[model samples]
Target: MTPDQATPLLDRVNLPSDLKGFSDTELRQIADELRHETISTVAETGGHLGAGLGVVELTVALHAVFNTPRDRLIWDVSHQCYPHKILTGRRPRAKTLRKGGGLSGFTKRSESPYDPFGAAHSSTSISAALGFAVARDLGASPEHGLGDVIAVIGDGAISAGMAYEGLNNAGHLKKRMIVILNDNEMSIAPPTGAMSSYLSRLYAGAPFQEFKAAAKGAVSLLPEPFQEGARRAKELVKSVTVGGTLFEELGFSYIGPIDGHDMEQLLNVLRTVKARADGPVLIHAITRKGKGYAPAEQAKDKGHATAKFDPATGEQKKAPSNAPSYTRVFADYLIREAEADPLITAVTAAMPSGTGLNLFAERFPDRTFDVGIAEQHGVTFCAGMAAGGLKPFCALYSTFLQRGYDQVVHDVAIQRLPVRFAIDRAGLVGADGPTHAGSFDIAFLANLPDFVVMAAADEAELAHMVATAASIDDRPSAFRFPRGEGVGVEMPERGTPLEIGKGRIVREGSRVAILSFGARLSECLRAAENLAARGITPTIADARFAKPLDQNLIRDLATNHEALITIEEGAVGGFGSHVAQFLSDEGLLDTGLKFRSMVFPDTFIDHDSPASMYAAAAMNAPDIEAKVLKVLDIASLAAERRA
Candidate 1:
């Protein structure tokens, strides 16, 4: 939206510098308007809503108090950065969030000077903030300049180990930095009574040197041994309370449990810290996710993500689906499997709903685990369960599974544990873009020795694969599937297990062949129809297992067909690459066979519609047809005929 069309305060405020002229009361108004603007923008664009809404006041207060672009204000995870983006000259493109060629849903360094550190995944902001502070103290010269560094991390994000690592280091360095814990999970009314607030205010009210010792004794969260030393010093501030001793133990001067929504309190706390802090300080500002909007506040997940919705009623305008989503299919099948097998259990790293494990959890709550934002722990935990003779399904997004790669290698793969990895979002996901794409799992998992890697051709195939993985009790196995609904294929009442390392022929043909390893089988079949209309019938096969190579099926295709093409919805080093290696090692390449590998292009595709992204990667149906024609040495002739 144009600055002219927005509310009075936002219209005048194009940048954080513009916030300087606004009074505290006016700043509160700007925050309120910014919240409305955020809701309206996300209602149209369908990006993260709740996190941004929660931080509307905090966003305004930070900018209004600090000299941003110079101060290096960082947001943890940055899903809450929409309001920050609006105050930093990105309001015009706010409605285009997560769209192709538009603003990112999270903070991006390339997008604006205010976004000094880019983040999508959680728990890295504290470290980045400290780096900036160290740089400023060392007199590093840059165009954006440098001042006091602040990392606004949420309570959920602060739970990760990496955040504590940054905190431990920062406390040791004693740098002049701020790490505001956006404590949305807490109540707005702090348990620490009015008396504690008065003491903190007094600490902030006094000059630095005069009250430094007294302030540290009173409000500084010291270790128990150190607290005894301050016993006499702390006696004046009797019955005063403060939270966050863990942070203080890590070396930070912890403050607050403050009401984050109160503009006066926020401004006062922020301004005091900006002037007074000489060491790492963690300000716990208690706010609520989906704070202002009633619909959002009441909804589960606090309306974290939404489709295009009616702003008044908060009703999503999603297109009706004829088929159950891939996630849903997996969940239902897993529940059925768990019904028969008492040993079957599931685990997901903070993505219960996204992976559809929430449904499974509802069926068997005791058998389900939601390890919060910790993929490494989730993977190892599954490995342990398997070791204890339990059938553990480590369900995780293909992108998030990357976080636990080392654990997979050491704890699972090397140990040869029977961990069934239900990998979801195994292709180009729409809206979330490259950061969330499941483009690498097949390549990484298939390359591991003694690992059984499979990809479902469709929802029915996904069902079968789930059963197959369950039966493989001696070794680790994984099956990948894409996002969104299946291709309206009829679901099986119960899945039947397929033989290990075997593939199935989808259609018989002549001259050339298209062997698919994943969800792209549908595209391959569509391309074959186009080829058949043109009097060329290509053999199509679903190479269910990426590893184990389906040697007999592969050899037969290479010997029978003049051309053999392998395609998958993965990056270059996955199924297709493995096939090429096998064909070469088996002396099949020496027989003048025209071999081609069709995979995602070697680049990070930006956010777009899934169809558009597939087209950009040249893996859509027409691209498949073109690959077939070119491999058959008829592409130029086909082009000439069309011309």
Candidate 2:
């Protein structure tokens, strides 16, 4: 297929099985077309554009070679699955990417049969692939047949300990699995650590020839009687000389620092490895993050994520009268605080730009640390900093923080270390979907002893929360804020620390009380306004702290109002669950007080706009209003027989 023909060919291929009929040359043409589609789609939807662009050729090569659906393909972090999605039956819906009821932004098993294993968190693909490989082996035998298991991971993802753990296990088992290391030298930001350095050395031609020569020399050195012994000895020497080479030691037949973008090289290498690989194989392919687009390639963070832009100019379309994003606001405040206090040190898990710590890093370069995808290390590292008398701000995404939960509980909370967690993306992240949603952090962190969890109602509150976290020195504290621009509110020059375990009434009313937490406060306010129009004044309170529940305020609200509701931008175990637990403990539930909790439904919400997702989850104004009216018996009374 030619370029024009390739477009129509791709348009017709909505499933991987459909591509089976196409020739390899035709498939390559389809890849080019897919890249074009992905770039155009992302230009409209505005997501992880560069990564997807980088993986287009790889995606085509993998699907063409492997029998997908039968052969499990797990994409680590899954930010680069746009091409895969396009090839696997979601092509028509590409334009609706990240919108409500549209295709997912990440690999989703429910989205397509070809997406055997889903992932959003980094470094999980290899482990997941190993699990599927094990399952397939267990189901099959030497007489039976088993399908291939491929894990397409990134170089940045390999920085995480979990990927190493998977690699170690896969190597130890000698599983017939393939791990494609997509090395772009980035993970939202430039990767760090000894592993990253090692990979960099491999990229720089440290010992490839030397190791091969040594192995050949060792084989020649063996006596006739001790040939087997010499073979084992050679393996041991090769492992050692590689500077504690973990992958080879673990037993993986490692191959290539090959060019990922070079189609011919990638295909030949992949085919060769697939044909002769008995044990596990790790293919290290180096490619640019934003391979095709010059603007994205030239971007500081490789256009990790973006707003909708023009395809011709690669310029983001400006919004009408845009307010400061929550991230920008946080970044600005962090910088201001760092400037005021020299002891204020900021840390992020390879997300300086994402967590709004880029400004802080810029202003206080000496104090900023990008720990790379190691969230567990980032948390404990921050704890160590705090113990050493430095104020450490551990900024991380709420979803990514899940990776460091144990560390947060064990290292920080257990020790009562004053490590301030600046948790960004604390709610349903638009486009990124459930895996990236900041749903469980509140519930997970709030439950821990010696931990203070606060969720900002808006950007102004986020500033105050940051100050509060900085001010609190007795125990570990975290402040979570949602993604996207702040609701245009008056700015505060300096953040004032609020009294702990306290909440404020935003609007005083009777009959019904709406307890709003995090970014859902605006929705609650809107709901309150709607209720007021119906002659039902609803009390609105911003319960800032998810942990250390404002018992006094909650009890008062329950006592005063005939009906009570709790609203939050999280799943079941978050603010609503805490409120239920509190009410149950206080014997408030038995008082015949009508109550309802408005939280994210117990399901994995797909990629969409934040507003649309909230609305779908019934956490929006109209839904909240409807629920509040129902709880107040207003809806029921309106339906009753007239006297």
Candidate 3:
């Protein structure tokens, strides 16, 4: 930061306490060095690059002004916490980010005292921070000495329903907390909804150079009911600070549209709030997503996420692709379906690119809707579309779909609307770990009445499932696919709809049958080859449908094979449990047929390669091979004893 100086300011700082010793100018220098360090760190270990870069000065200001760990600072989604993590004594391990047994990409309470609350999902920070504020007053942990509670939420995150709930509750309670609205005008995608438009209007006029003028300008934007109260609050602030009309209407001491990049402004504003704030405060800071880094700033997503890249050139280093990803395959197939049906439409909750719906949006802009991080609303909106006789595919990550479970059950499943759920990232997603891993969707969705749940075993099967879901007109249907590339299998030009509740046998064998669901079909095939080495030839079948499962096929497998094994890339109460329940009901297990269900263990697996994660869960190829042998060996031992 100080070019001529021999020593860098960041080298002296190991923790937030070290920042307290520095002068304002030195703190600014530290912020600059911190930004540089962040860029360098993420270059080595790619992660959420833009957010941390955007909040470098703010991260410094928060840590310098607030007594974090003692004073809780919760980051909404915590993707922006990279700079915060570096300052909080985690700089040494920064390179280990998002790896197995390494630092998490998001905040974790277990990781550090500074990270008082953990978050990977969005919009929960305000509520969590508010809870901390209330707990601080209640003296919940007297030993920790909680001082202040601050929540830094993005413009996109603040648009969600839960944030509004937190705002409403906080407004009523009027606690001494702070909510810093980081108005970057970009999230993983561009910010949407009325709130985004409102924020854009707040800073677009360039009237915010003077605080009083900004206050006067910001007030006129409020609704009639809110405007009078906003004017009173603006009058109350008396030229020292500005009133944010919407936040003020919610009874927060709205503060700024200040330059988040400005070290002086951030420090002054934060320090002023810390010294004198009595009620809830909202500081509006307008910043860029990829503030300092040129490559990130120029990129479409503002470099929200990336692979390891060159620090100098910002060119990413990626392995050569052997096949198209499941996401891309789904998007391509969905486009084909859309071409055939005029009523076919798509929806995603702020993750167009992630769900591969960005491609669909490009093809049919009118048919694709992005509901902006509000999964609950998105689900119901799709249901409404379905009710209006339009075929709507609600494409959401398996993890994100959990947020809309209640709506899915009520609006879609109860009414039996023909809403197609295209579930992406439906297994142990690597890097992002358990928080984002889609483990419960199969169990949760399959449990509902008349709900058709399918898991694609490969890219081609995924294409077929998309067509199958589109054809199912009377009831709701969902199909899940994993992250990453398909197994380089030959793909069909277009999808031919498969029969509901039926499965197909890939190979014929005797003594044992391995019935696989989802992407684990490939692993079953791999295990079969290994089993063949020992003269234990096992049959392999792909169970396409989880819910209305092919009972005839299950009965046949039980009747023929000495042992049957069910495997899926999901939690315990999913496909395996359903199959087991059916077998027990039919008295198939009563006839002494040995059976095993290989699934993810009861615990949450940490961030790792999917291979490592499955290995830990004992659901890999070797695990499958081991389970078959264990079941057959037990039968062999029983026979030996009988002899």
Candidate 4:
């Protein structure tokens, strides 16, 4: 059931403006209902549960204190925006979250006016809010008429250099803005690096008891009755391990290290700040990642994200897997290689479990590094390791690696470092949407010199590539694998590295040849089956290497077959474009060979099931078959003959 159905108080809140007359007690009741609703919705739809739960009270407080839409409110990462969505006229569609044509998992500018800024990546909110603040002063976005721009950033987000950069610039500009540091002490993984420790030092003492004890002069700033209890809080804050003076030095009015869950305290503090804030102010509100819901609070990732689940027990309802996931395969193969080589080390940008580096970390703790939300740093760090005579596997998601492209070019590629880039989620990832899609990596990386790019056609191919990457210690190399389960091929006990710049002929036929890259080999086979049934058997070859385009195999296919089709699960200018350029340079296209390159449609595809997404991009089995038939002019020739 929705929050409005459960609580009458929330039923009245059709918009943020509706929260205008809400009393502190009423707002608290609304928060409780919002938490339940978030839990209920996630139990059905399954998304970022813990983050939304943690920010329920904060969401209520922000809407109550500030004028949203008109006054910009941006969520860092926006993974914690479910509650905000529910409050802002999206409650009815909450059950359809992350599904095709449903509400986005993260805030979207097109989805609503309330979501002034969209975000799926972390450490971007502060910068975006600062821009909005500046824009308001300059009267740029007159349609929104922005005032009091707010960025509710998480503790983990502040660890990034971008956050600090934004903070520094905002401080210098002296804009009237608010930065709510939602210090939940947890990101997707437990936070890493110096900032997490510094935040821990900000609220070291037992605040309540200290405030209760020091009730006189220190507590005078708070409301009269709360003085006794709040005095101890002030004393506890005063006795901080490190001062908020660092923020003051940045020219921000530092406040809190306060209890984020407490509605009364949240209302009091936010109301006070709203009334008096002249320049950029930072409110550090301490919170639990999974607050209110017991099952979520007890979860391993603090219920960061989930599949549809039973609300009471928090038991996830997931489909049974036929084979091991590509992630597991990559991890196991890497571990196997690392066991043989002492020089091998692994690195990730704060995604240990997500990147499957957690397994490597467990086996070789000394060799694994989780460089917190800092992709640029992680890449350069790997470069340094490679320079120091270490085989550093810089494991990162394809999207996150984009943030480190500069470093990849400057530190790794240019220097010709033997850094192995393990790019995960290398295609259209479902649920998380276009923001997280790995569409550009193939095109971006393949263009660089001294870089060997490979895409695994199946799980077995992935293992082989891992071994291949381990063996290649001359220059930079990367191998990409998709997000979910592999194609259930018989895996070898130990991977034997394949010859570089080579591809394997899966099925040989005469009429038309389909050259496949990455995991689309299965679909190519399926297309072959369809064509075979129609009395036209097609040849299929898996071009494992994208950069060192299997020239011999590509040349053979073009020469033998009347029609040739190249398919990859990436944007244009990737495998297909490279192949086209090769054929042109070699004068192969001068022959009467029908050539077609089927890549992802030249656009950002939205969130949908992987199969459906591929279909939309016209790279599925049927699409492949259609491309072959059209290129061969089978339908036209047959129809003319029949007539």
lDDT by residue for model 4 (1-643), tens: 2333467888898999999888888999999988888888999898899999999999999999888878889999999999999999999999989999999999999999989899999999988998888888898978776578899999888999999999999999999889999998999999999889888766665754324223222132345676566555556656543445667678687767678999887887888777767788888888998898788889878999999988877889999999999999999999999999999999998789999999999999999999999999999999999999999999999999999999999999999999999999999999898999999999999999979999999999999999999999899999999999998899988788889899999998998999999998998999889778878889999999998989999999999999899989889989999999999999999998889999888788999888888878888877787787788888763444233
Per-candidate Cα RMSD to the true structure, in Å, reads 5.7, 4.7, 4.6, 3.4
Candidate 2: worst 10 consecutive residues by lDDT?
213-222
Estimated TM-score per prediction? 0.91, 0.89, 0.94, 0.94
Query: Which digits, one per residue and each the tens of the lDDT, describe model 3 over residues 1-643?
Result: 2223333789888889888999999998898788888888888888899999999999999999998778889999999999999999999999999888899999998899999899999999999988999998898989888599999999999999999999989988999999999989988999789889888877665754554424443443333565677577567666552336678788887777788998998887788788777888888888999888899999999999989988787899999988899999999999999999989999999999999999999999999999998999999999999999999999999999999999999999999999999999999998898899999999999999999999999999999999999999999999999999998989999999999999999989899999999999998999889778778789999999998999999999999999999999889999989999999999999998998888889998999888898888888877787788778885563343233
- Per-residue CA lDDT of model 1 for 553-591, tens digit only, reads 999999999999999989989998899999999999999
Better of 1 and 4 by lDDT: 4
Clashing pairs in 1: none
Instruction: Please give the clash total of every predicted structure, in order.
Output: 0, 1, 0, 5
Say which candidate scores most in lDDT: 3
**lDDT (10s digit) by residue, model 2, range 1-643:** 1123238668768777777788777777887788888888888888888898888889888877777777788899998988888888777788888777887788887778778777878899888888888888788533324878899999889888899899888988888999998988887888888877887766565545434323422232223554466466557665444422556677776665667877776676667666666768777777888888888899988888888998877889868755789999888888877778888999998888887777787778899999889999899999999999999999899999989988988899989999999889988887788888888888888888878889999889988988888889999999999888889999899888888889999999998899988888998888778667778889999999888889999999998888889988887888888898889999888898888888888898777877778777877777877787677667663333111
Please give the lDDT score for candidate 3.
0.89
